[model samples]
Target: MSLRHTLLAAVAAVAMTGLAASAQAKTEITWWHAMGGELGKKVEEIAANFNKSQDQYELKAIYKGNYTETMTAAIAAFRAGQQPDIVQVFEVGTATMMAAKGAVYPVYKLMNDSGLKWDPNAFLPAVVGYYTDTDGNMLSMPFNSSTPVLYYNKDAFEKAGLDPNSPPKTWQELAADSKKIIDSGAATCGFTTGWQSWVQIENFSAWHNIPIGTKSNGFGGLDTQLTINSPLDVRHIGDMAAWQKDGIFKYGGRRSDSAPLFYSGECAMYMNSSGSYAGVKGNAKFAFGVGMLPYYDDVKGAPQNSIIGGATLWVLQGHDKAEYKGVAAFFNYLSSPEVQADWHQFSGYLPITQAAYELTKKQGFYEKNPGTDVAVKQITLNKPTENSKGLRFGNFVQIRDIINEELENIWAGKKSAKQGLDDAVKRGNELLRQFEADNS
Candidate 1:
């Protein structure tokens, strides 16, 4: 071969070798998440943006199914020593994640160790409080936090002769309005709900200054018992059961299966995660307004702040040291005001950082969007009391299922509200006891 051709081939070979080495040197960070549909696409976009912003790392977000399935997959993968660097766990799975000591790298320590300028106080209390240890140390990074809000059809309200701009603020007013809506045939049913256990029981107890369990709703310790059968709880559940018979309240199904009922104009109002804002905006055919979750005015301090739903980002163990720094960088990027505000504006999630919230307002998002701020206002309406803070019982995921089943039984006439709730408490306490023993 000629000397010129040989040198050219050598140069090409050297260049190819350099490219392969650079690719190998890039740190790949894996994040397993539960975000699905358009939300999942947004997750990918965020990851892609992060990848483009930095050359040292590449992030890959994989959908691991629903919240429960994502958590389960993470746990199983951890046991197999193959867990991702990060996982998205629902608020209900907080206890499970906390119990997996040595498996999780607490966000506080992660940030501090990485020498990042992280201020714990920068996060909104109502959202971050759920994933903090008793010492007030944050265990996970708050992401996609949301609370229940009242979503009403404005067109239906006007037809029913109710103020379209005003939604019911109290339980008594809600019932009266629901009757009016049904009687006037503005909608087939007055209202339906999503997340029956979450909205009906968990937030219900919190909003009314009642506890779902003792020991500060399991924040105090693992030894906690369900107080879900309280007098007020029974009364509320019984009222819902009665309303079901009169078409005032419809139990369309569980875990947001009923959301279509509201979006399709089958029901006039819905109580669901504020995260549903984006979905409702796209799907609903008529004008809708967001309102705070209704409270019973008769109860003193009844309108206590509501607790949050949605999930947090947990940094899992078993990744390389280089990857840890990448994880920290990714988290910092995710928490930046610009990124967070954009996410909140697009997805209807509560921006975890106070700075993000302020940035969003400064951007005139709430002013232009109207009811988009209802979740933030409702959850931050008052300082969270012990009852209003949040729940953290171990085995709560399963307990939530038991609560749902009992509620279904009550709605189906197999048992009264009081009896079904009583049974739920009894059955849930057994699981709590088991969790306590295992975690203790």
Candidate 2:
């Protein structure tokens, strides 16, 4: 009842309120990603949702250009000790990311350190395997994973006197159908592709169960050699060259440069990443259908699983424990079924979890969008063989550039498929050896 005692209690209550507010303040973590357009919006939305959910941390998503540019920037930032808490690296950069000593904080380690009980089994095997180390520990979290698929203009197929409902299931069928489309004037070109090496060499070898390189595609050992220039690979490229001459297949530049051809209605058939679905849906004017990528159909174990093409989230090493905790929490939020399903349905990326796939299936998202599951079915219909799992090699970005050069020579009729690929393998092996020595 004394005025002095009452004043002291009031002041203590006000100070306690201030302390509680300060304790619940969020820790900020930066995430540098390569996503743009609608995908970028989804990333920001996820961050916003997580920031509102628990108030323990806030994830800041920053656009850092495309895959190669993002990786380059990350490396530069790392050298300067200014790297973000997390960086999205493409599948091709897996080896480079792993080889960088003390540059990355493994996802498993971060989760464990933060007391987050993470389950590796929750992710699709083919996806998780790409980011996991030789010891089967996950080095990064798989997000926005995708695989190549066939997209055809149904109107073009009908005009060519082919069954609009049925798509080419084999390479022979696709070639034959493409010819008809061109001959019938259904499109300016029958078929065109983005990233010739990615669709033709990388996923092509995996889908056909052919080795891209020795030693389990370089994951088994550090001293693996380039073996992608095999007889089967040469034969496939030779067939494509012949098709090019016959005006059935058109060659575009690397990556998704050919996407404009398909979107502009110049190409009747396209083989590109499933992640392009969102863009195609917005741009295509005619009725379109999606199908699984065509394979040889006769190769033993043909129709094997296709590897992913998108990127994953890797935590950088120099960040403090508080930042790492925020990174782990953000990853956990991103991996939930609701988030995964919404993303898969929105952007055509494969749902990284069985629960997300099931959620989409139950909600009839696939039924409403008939071809939405084509990528999922193509990647999961068959178990992954050694060849189908994924690729890991140092200086792979340079290796991809070499592949582009050789394939371009073949397309331009300057070299035969066998010769071009042989030269690429030779040049690529030198880089591989150098990388082995440097990282050893």
Candidate 3:
């Protein structure tokens, strides 16, 4: 009960306090995402799973507006030395992200640094090729890759006297069916598209195996030209223009803004990302179906694989070694088959790994869900052609804006599709050249 006992009690209390702090403290990793609504919820759910599964690290996801805003924030934050550990950048931002070599830690390098065994073959070639360097090293992890596909209202098709179970596989068939839907008054608009630049222009070239640009669509190098003015591209746009005149096709909005029209049953057919399934399933009042993106029946090698349009997770450079391990651990968790399969099922994004696809198949997810496998089949049905590999051009965000402006003029009858596209190519090419010069 003297000085010795008092000193011993104080030391024991201090030891207990240290143990408690060590037990409760957890390393936190910040993830900046562009998802909102249901997609945002799914991202949080995945993060929660990772947090619950391990005590070593905790992932914190922050939605940083849409794709453009997210990319801009990441760049600004990196400059300010306040960037999150992970940033979600869209497919269009691939060139921009790759060009920022000083700001990024290549996903392949991160995986290897963490000693995580990652197999490139586990991803769909078309999906992985978009985010990889020429040597096929992954620059980012494909988080929510999706390609354009057809969405149709079955009830509208039946009312239009077309086969509800069958969707048009060729551009000609789509036109004819769209006309029928319009004539039958099945829907206010026969066909509408979300992300006209992404689906019709960018993926149109890929699906028909026509080049969207030269220099390997910018994957080979940065000095790429806007070739959407090609004969085939012109022909396709011209047809769409003629259809717009006939009321067979309606221009929804610039980028994925037409989704609501389709979901509202105002449009009989819609063309958009496979990822749109989540929105459609949530909002569509009528029965719906999904099909492969249509191509020109007469085009040689038509119906090629479509390129991805979703975002990927890129690890920013300059973080400490401990933080890099946390990033790698989170990536590994996200890439696991169970996590990937659940994410694919919940969000309609295609699973990025082969193991995830196999796990989904084993779980009978496809059989029970019916349309869930459409993305996998569409992406893997054919090996990616030169055009189908993916587009990788500089200043693509501005280029897309230019394309939207030109396409809007065409839809408003201010210009012919051929005239509009030709002008888009000319102007877009000038911008591309300028970007090339500046970046190079």
Against the true structure, what is each candidate's TM-score? 0.93, 0.94, 0.92
Error of 3 at 420 (Å): 1.4
Highest lDDT, which number?
Answer: 1
Lowest-sum lDDT 10-residue window in model 1: 111-120
Cand. 1 Cα-lDDT? 0.93
| TM-score of candidate 3 on Cα atoms, chains taken together | 0.92
* Top-scoring candidate (TM-score): 2
Tens digits of per-residue lDDT, candidate 1, 1-440, equal 99999999999999999999987788999999999998999999999999999999999999999998999999999999999999999998999888889899999989888886778888899988888988889999988999999999999999999999999999899999999999999998988889999999999999999998999999998999999999999999999999999998999888889988998898999999999888899899999999999988999988999999889999998888889899999999999999999999989999888899999999999999999999999888888889988999998888989999999999999999899999999999999999999987
Q: Which pairs, if any, clash in model 2?
A: none
Tens-digit lDDT string for candidate 2 (1-440): 89999999999999999999888887889999998877889889988898888777888889999888998999999999999999999988999899886999999989999998788788888878888877888888998889999999999999999999999999999999988888899987878888777889999999999999999899987799888789889999999999999878888678888888888888898999998887788899999999988889778888898888889998899878888888888888899999999988988899999899999999999989989899998889787878988889889989999999999999999999999999999999999999999999
Which is the better candidate, 1 or 3, if ranked by TM-score?
Answer: 1
Give the residue spans of candidate 1 off by over 4 A: 1-24
Model 3 poorest 10 in a row by lDDT: 116-125
Provide the global lDDT of candidate 2 against the true structure.
0.89
